[model samples]
Target: MNNPDSLTNHFLIAMPNLADENFARSVTLICEHSEEGCMGIVINRLTDLHLCDIFDQLGITPDKASHANDVVYLGGPVQSNRGFVLHEPLGKWESTLSVTDRFGVSTSRDILEAIAENRGPEKFIVALGYAGWGVGQLEREITENSWLSGPANQDIIFNLPLEQRWKAAAQLVGVDLTTLSSEAGHA
Candidate 1:
């Protein structure tokens, strides 16, 4: 059985051998983990799209101060067209999943509207889609050495430059991924 409490509010750093193109070199923020399943957003994969593109498509006039030019992220492979906003200073939003005292994920238009008007959370990252795992799936992956997870650090998620988040998240567990060998070792 998977330990439901073990993964919530953690960062899942993809192992070097995890060759899936979608997740390679990815750093995922595990927002929820339960017997039911797991869900997360890839914190480091910037897509070609920008926040302004999303706002324009949705007919929301983004505030100039809202960092509308920031690159949008490819959160994960699931529900690629949906938007998930990870933000700090968690507050009430139309549809939000409070991940921790300092972070939350919002999936509602109202929050987007608030952001467009510069009334949303102090810091936010807009992403499309999310990574999901069925019951026991993530635990199995961990046991297989497919990922290295540790407590999520807001600095990596909210402050680090996009190109550095993957390495920084791995370093949270004292790992320097560059030094890791792709093949599993036999003791």
Candidate 2:
């Protein structure tokens, strides 16, 4: 969207009061946003599954080296069975939604294959499913103080430890989430 405030390439830091299990204490990377909806991945939520599990399930080989890469994140609740690969320095892929010139979310096997062999982008995060919001839903949630959003930070997504992302993302915009009430106010 041409709208300057479109949250594409931003982070949605869940507010303290939002108790939805899927979103509570989550830091979601908004990769694509439009009049239709918004699609993002929960960058900080870890699942029992790992990249090796994905490689095995897909019959990909040379996965032994991936032992150091237990980096599969629980992206969100929708399409839980599918995989989305978020990476930087957007490269060509079979099915990638280019988030920014510097970022992309790919759902193609080729990207995975390249990654398996160390021929992929410098950094990547394999996520299961994704967080989605229909038109106006996310905006309304923000209006209700369910989330605090700001421009996406690469370090927070790819470099920082998962446990720190929620607060770190919020800090990008100068909000100290620890000081916020877990209760919403009503006039």
lDDT of 1 by residue, 136-169 (tens): 9998999899999999999888898989998998
TM-score of each: 0.94, 0.94
lDDT score of residue 159 within candidate 1: 90
Error of 1 at 42 (Å): 0.1
lDDT of each: 0.91, 0.89
Off by over 4 Å in 2: 67-69, 183-187
Give each prediction's root-mean-square deviation over alpha carbons: 2.0, 1.6
Off by over 4 Å in 1: 1-4
